[model samples]
Target: MGTFRIEGGAPLKGEITPQGAKNEALQVLCTVLLTPEKVTITNIPDIIDVNKLIALLSNLGVKVQKLGHGAYSFQADEVNLSYIESEAFKKEGAALRGSIMIVGPLLARFGKGYIPKPGGDKIGRRRLDTHFEGFINLGAKFRYNEEDHFYGVEAERLKGTYMLLDEASVTGTANIVMAAVLAEGKTTIYNAACEPYLQQLCNMLNSMGAKITGVGSNLLEIEGVDSLGGCEHRILPDMIEIGSWIGLAAMTQSEITIKNVSWDNLGVIPSTFRKLGITLERRGDDIYIPAHTEGYEIQSYIDGSILTIADAPWPGFTPDLLSIVLVVATQARGSVLIHQKMFESRLFFTDRLIDMGAQIILCDPHRANVIGLGFKSKLRGILMSSPDIRAGISLLIAALSAKGVSIIQNGDQIDRGYERIDERLKAIGAKITRID
Candidate 1:
């Protein structure tokens, strides 16, 4: 196991050029399976999750080449989709929940797709029912045997139709979009997750000849094509990273410039955080965080001013980053009620904050009311192990801003999505060292 030992209360400075989005890189890499022609992806982050997806693709017989830094070329003359039942497949596939994403493309193109199970954050009861529902609606037959916990999908030809997803699951929406791109007719996906990742997927698919409209909205209109071709695409900067850095700068009272942030992709995140009394300045492609802003009070409703942060479907605050918001609120001067409606187990980590001397009330499984004691000035650094990717980074931000020293174990969780995290923080003057 690896750990991050950080001497806290060091203000982070300098500029950090954000890496390409890891979530987008997964879908773009998997899209190579949809065509025999080579597809080139630029600005891909060298992260753990992206590496695992590349390993999965290579196992399936895609020729993956690294063309020097952050660039790669992938071509699948013939994909060995049959070998997915091997022990190696199960071990690696279980390591990343994003492995579930390949199921739809495999089934649509090869008529059968097998996966033991998808692994990801244990935040809550994430439903694959929406994914299965989309495929079932597209005429794919599914069989699940609890003995092996493997899911098998086979279809002669996927006939596209209207699909009303049970929830706006991020990957669920992505899985169906991949399956529908080559189906027989138009696929009308209602209640879809139109996150920036999905938009990137759609843009890549469109460049590859799949006709898709409504790129950033909830309702997606995907018109099936006979097959897709190859095109070059660059993944966007990570929005979750943007959120994490914002929290980091505010908590440490650092003046940092985050470069190349896709301002348009942020949608409502800026406004959502502004409600928390965080100020940001947009200078070209960068967002600058000023130093030494006192904890501004959160704005409340018309009737009463009780601060609240809620995560909803896309165009709303992302549920994936509500943990970041919760962590940031711990140092603010006011109180905030964070509602994580989609996942039941996501809020369980509030106890860890309580351990770190944060005044948080876990109202329920999905809600936590945090009353910031106005920069408590004394966080007794403790040994804490990371639980998941986003939560792990949140803890790192918390650790970096604390008064004393902290040791964070299971650093691989943070490595899963973030690239060069320790080095990047160090470049910004954070006193962090990675140890094994």
Candidate 2:
């Protein structure tokens, strides 16, 4: 029930410190259930999703204490297993994709797990098959009603084995990994999503005395231990938000410095943006976007014509941030095709961009060709509804660069990942007003 009115045509300038990774922080926070000791976490993003997860954990009898800004200590020293079947637990479980992760640790440590239908970005059919299959391979009996959509898994001591996931679903991979950590033997996960988030999860597991190697790759080896101890782990920086901020800086011709970026982990992200001729500078762990950057040409061939930006699995461009990049691409000098292979409906929001006077070709559900009419074209803002998190942030970026004041309803969508986005943009001299 909130809206953001962004006046167009100002590139964000100033300093922004990216928050902890939303994806990784959630996974690590949930891992507290694996042990009965306090797990301290730093660099946690104070976003809505993280807050919701913390609430879920608290409701399940985990002690979450805020130590400082972006720092917290969680102790599930004695999780109340009976609350797992409570209505409040089911409602909270249905509130997030990451909530499903609780099942693995619960099943491993408490002998059973219960979860209701989960909720997240309604992009497409996100399945938990891979997660359940891993549990089943380790000897789990699960029964769920399709009509009521409740799930319960009664798992014995999970004995690790090789798991070839049907798809490299991010949450699915994390769930299985969490389950396998306290299993009886070795768990080999193939086609695993070893993105920086996943890597952080593995690191946290290692800190808890779990044996996990081959982090940051498609394959991972996890050697289960009898039990795990508490550990302190720092969540990685939010690269997706960093990338969004980078795109915002470039599109608005603003000079901004983004701090605490994990430069090494951002493999291929810089180059992927470089394809559009955006100049990216790395000063230690900070990323700076120089002002008045000449936007690049989305080149096609060696002759330097129009090209496209697409998403694939990791090592390829991330599908989640493609929407933000596509919006930024609209202000570039040339055209680029954006093929969003993972989701069918992500490109549908581009119609709002077209309404702003940007030239875009919507070729079916999965693809779009965006021709930047140049910044001089003057995109005039309009009233819009935010669709999802990334796409919602993309629309906010567009509104920021457009010619008039634009109102973005459903601004809370952007609040899911980016922390204090309005305050952050305001600090950078952006004309954004949040109204409820």
Candidate 3:
């Protein structure tokens, strides 16, 4: 297990650029399997999860070439479908949550797809029923191996149909959309996840000759195409990372400028941060966060009620940043309730922050009430292990603003999402070291 040794209480300065969206990269990379031609993806974040998926694609016989930093070209003209049934693939696919997505594209292009029970952050029960159920709805036969926890989907040719998703699952929507693009008829997905990442997948598919309408909305209409061609796609900056940087700047009282943030795509993120009384300026395409010398105050409702920030579907605040918000609120002037409605165990990380002297109540599995210390009491560092990606970064941010040194075990969790995080923070004057 790798570790991060951080010396706290130094305000970071200089400019930082957000990495390409990790979620978007996962979805788009799988799309390479949909076509036999070369699909070049730029702005790919150099992260663990994305790299693992890329490696999985290569193992499956996708011709992958490194164009340069943050860029890769992939061609799946000679994919080895037999590899999906191998023990090696089962082990590899089981390690990554994103691997579940490959099944859709494979089942669409080939006659079948199989995956082991995919693994990822143990935040809660992230069911794969949505993805397989969508495939079943589109005329694919689904099978599950009870002993090995493996899943398989097979069909001669998928026929498109209407599907109203049980939940607006991002990965599920992306998976189903990929399959539907090569189906026999029109596929209409209602109550779909309309996250910018999903929208990017739809748009990318459209560029490759798939007729997809309702680019940025929940209801998506897909007119199946006989074949899809190659297209070069650039991923948007990761909003979750951008939000983390914003929280880090405020918590450390730093003046940091986040460059090329794709302002329009960052729905409700900025305003949501502003609600915590953090001052962030929009300088052209960049976000400039000034030092909060006097500390920030949490905003109240119009009726002067306690502010409650909750996660919802797209256009609402993202659940990924709720951990960052909870950490940032630890030092704010007032109290706020962070309702992580999406995942149950995400709020459990608050116990680590509370150990650092932050006043936080883990109200339940789903919610946490944080009473800001207003910087009156400085957080002291302690040895802690990162539970998940988002919580790991949140803890790192807390460690940065704390007094003395903090050791973070299982640092790979943070590295899975954030690209070169310690090196990036070091460039901005943060005293962070990676102890591998």
Candidate 4:
């Protein structure tokens, strides 16, 4: 365990580049399993979850060579299929939720895939039914070992067909797409997740000779290729991190220029913050947020009802940013309801904000009503523990904006996603120190 000692009230200013998308990195790294040739990927975030996946790939006998900073070439010419049955594989595979994605590509290329009970942040129930169902739909036989809590899928040869997913699950869609890329016939996936991550995966697959259409739409069509080859891919900047910086700037009244945010793919994230009265300017590929001295005021609906901010699937406001939004709302001028529709426990971290003297009403497990103090009441920092990746950053933002020193334990959770967060924030003039 580690702790971050943050001295609040210092305005952070300067430019910081966003790390590569963690979600996208997971999908792209897993796609390397589909091809025997060298796949060179750049802009890979140096985070714990991503590193774990890379280690898992290396353990499975994929040749991994680090080329430079945030770049690697992976060649899976001789994958050790038997490693999946080893106890070490079970231990490594269960370390992160992204490990489950290895199943699809492995099954597609090697005819078999297995996953131990995966572990990740305990936010809510993240079911794997969508992934398994999609695989089964493509003619894979699925089985579960109740005693070991393991999942296995096998098929002689995958014959692609049509599958309408129950929801646009991001990883589920990625898994199915990777599996379908090398299947026998044409595969049509309706209600697929069209997040920039998936689109990048499709583009990378296309570069590797997989025939895929509908790159940025919910419905995707894939004509299975006999094989895939090496391709170079660069991941987009993490939009969730960009949104967090927006919230951090608002809360601390900082002038921050977030570089290369891929503004077109950010969807409603910018406008969603604008609803909370946070002003931002897009400079080509970057987003610049000036220090909010006039104080942010929540914007009500046209009919004059209180504003409600909730999360949805892609092209909608991401659930990951809701925590940052909730923390930012603490310093806003008016009250707003934050409904976290995706994860039930995500809103529970507001209790720590409430303890820090923010006016927050925990409506339930899934909703929070934040009454913005508008800087009239300043938050006094205290010792806190991080809950998850997103909430950990939210707490760090709160600590930075508070009136006193705050110590946050469980800093590993934050490092799992954000790459050297304290170092980056310090570069932008934040008063943060990491202690092991």
When summed lDDT is taken over every stretch of 10 residues in candidate 4, the lowest stretch is 342-351
Candidate 3 ranges beyond 4 A from true positions: none
RMSD of each: 1.4, 1.4, 0.6, 0.7
Candidate 2 stretches with Cα past 4 Å from truth are 303-305
Candidate 2, residue 36: the lDDT equals 94
Cα lDDT of all candidates, in order?
Answer: 0.86, 0.86, 0.96, 0.95
Error of 1 at 267 (Å): 1.4
> Which residue pairs of candidate 1 clash?
97-119
Question: At residue 191, what lDDT does model 3 achieve?
Answer: 89
Model 2: lDDT to the true structure: 0.86
In Å, residue 143's CA in model 2 sits off its true spot by 1.4
By lDDT rank, best first, the candidates go: 3, 4, 1, 2
Q: Candidate 3 clash total?
A: 0
Q: What's the C-alpha lDDT at position 204 in model 3?
A: 96
Among these predictions, the greatest lDDT belongs to 3
